[model samples]
Target: MTTRAGLITSVTLLLFVALVAASALAQTNDSVAAACDAKVKAPDYSLPEWPEKAEVKVFIVAADFNPEQIAAILTPLRNWSAVAEATGSQVTFVYSGPTAEHQDCLNCLTIMRGKVHDNQKHAAELQATVNQGEQTILYARLVIDRVIPNLTALTNAVAHELGHNFGLRDCFECRAGTTVMGLIRSSDGLTGPTRCDVAQVRRVYDHVRIYSAEVKRRKPQQVAKIVPVDEGEEPVDDDTPIVVKKP
Candidate 1:
């Protein structure tokens, strides 16, 4: 009932539509990749990362948070653990219950509800103390504002703060509702770390692993030496520092 030329034309139109759709999908993927790269702000200095396969104990400094609030606060930690496993990162965070201990303890991440004021003065903030010489995070203190409006905001705040503990900085230019590390909280119910955030985490830990291996290879003799130097002591000959690069 149809001419050969007409059938050929119909097939050609279908192929054209398919090609356009594929091209659009490819462009979208490329855009997402570019955005991910832009959102990751790598420092020029050596990255401070958790030791390989380190289990960072999470301590809630204050016991005032209710069950729901506590659950919201902890959700991000568990989500980050899953992200780490999926991305081949060696770090994991385990909640160790409420703590009366000081915030300076090693391998501990303390979270407490308090007044946090920064330039943006968002719902939460984290201060990570890093041992720069060893390129490792000693401990971190996360302070959350006590007056979050809802559980969704609380979860997002915790997730964003935890990103800092993993050595990520805020991406002010990133679109809101896209990634947890963005300056603006997501509005579309995103409360966990996105693929971009996890990818950066993997990149950081990978850098640490590669650097450690290179150090051992270059200075095999000094790898086992743990001598403590005086504050003002002169540097030793084999104590040459390795400059860490952002991967």
Candidate 2:
């Protein structure tokens, strides 16, 4: 039988251990900020040659959210700059107070179509097809809300959702593991969709395919070591932090 004082000491020790673990996880989450060389060496991602110029607009409905929350939501927006440059496109960000007038003039398209979306207008206009449908848009909402686990998960959600609008459907293996589209549904254990997603802007603009035939040709090459399972080692997951690219 443990004494009361002894029990309290054990509890305190457990709490301290838990806090230490949480701190370590927080550091891991900020891995991108620590990168010094990621942008420099990637063969695929350089200053993407603009076939013409891409016009990407981000309309964030942030009225209901606190400014601090909005800032957190925008934290991943920097990745958009990288994505845009890779695609040879220009990006426009639309958010609270500053873009109030533009909301009235905004084009009606999907923002997100979840039960609780960051923005309502985008939800109302979201349209999905039989092949690549509702779930794609829903995943983006989860990313915006930061309901997913990591930066990889969030970035995957955005990339997947944007894929749906373009007419690309979920990839085959994406239904199981850590794909940009698969992570959301697989993590939740849901049925897979039938169709694929495609890019809408390609009709009028020079499209840089994201995870498609073109981007497939341009996908990031593994500069770091990749041990195959046959070599008595497990293959590295893309999300694994292997080589710290020092910028």
Candidate 3:
């Protein structure tokens, strides 16, 4: 009992709905692609610092970083650590000097701040690999320099470098309010990681699983333990030895 015109109208409505659904799906895929351009792959090489151990050891390799500068570096780290913990991916940092002990530490983040190399114009550089054959990173080292020496710039640089260390890529053009993973300095003037930044941390680390056999083979010794502290506590004193705080 249906007319030909009625059949055509019904077909048109169905096509419209299908088109809307396809468009929505495409947008979702694009959003995922934009956020994680370089997703964290399965680790061919594992480190003791990552996964369930939940600790990241930091060694200050450069003599240039005074206590104030060190504290500035720690601020964003502390914030990010808290963000990771909120998502059930626990992480804390143990600050250390460039002693022989640090040389033997397997998965520490060795930080050096000084003049950038001739070929490097960026404010910072992060290197972590073994002979470039193995794609997995066992350790991450950060070298920071003054491409634009301002407080906000340097702080944001540290935050951005830390994001790379945490296995995130530059999602500069992603539709977010602000992020530390921008390719260039953001005019938003944010000196720390934003909500978008923390969300990335959660995405990467929250469901991380440790491979037991890999940990057994690498067996890195714990450099220090973390002590719980209030989030609003003052920065550590200049002359005091570096300490690890619970996230």
List, residue by residue over 170-221, the lDDT tens digit for candidate 2. Answer: 3323324322333232133222111111121222123232323444345354
| Model 1 agreement with the true structure over 48-130: per-residue lDDT tens digits | 45666778999886575788888988888898877767545667899998877546667888888766543223456555665
Tens digits of lDDT, candidate 3, 22-125:
66545534443454434422211222124444577788755656677777677766766766654345666567655332242455677776554431334566
Prediction 2 global C-alpha lDDT: 0.31
Using lDDT, give the best candidate's number: 1
Listed per candidate, the RMSD to the true structure in angstroms reads 16.5, 22.6, 15.5
**How does each model score on TM-score?**
0.65, 0.33, 0.56
Model 1: per-residue Cα lDDT at residue 113: 71
Better of 1 and 2 by TM-score: 1
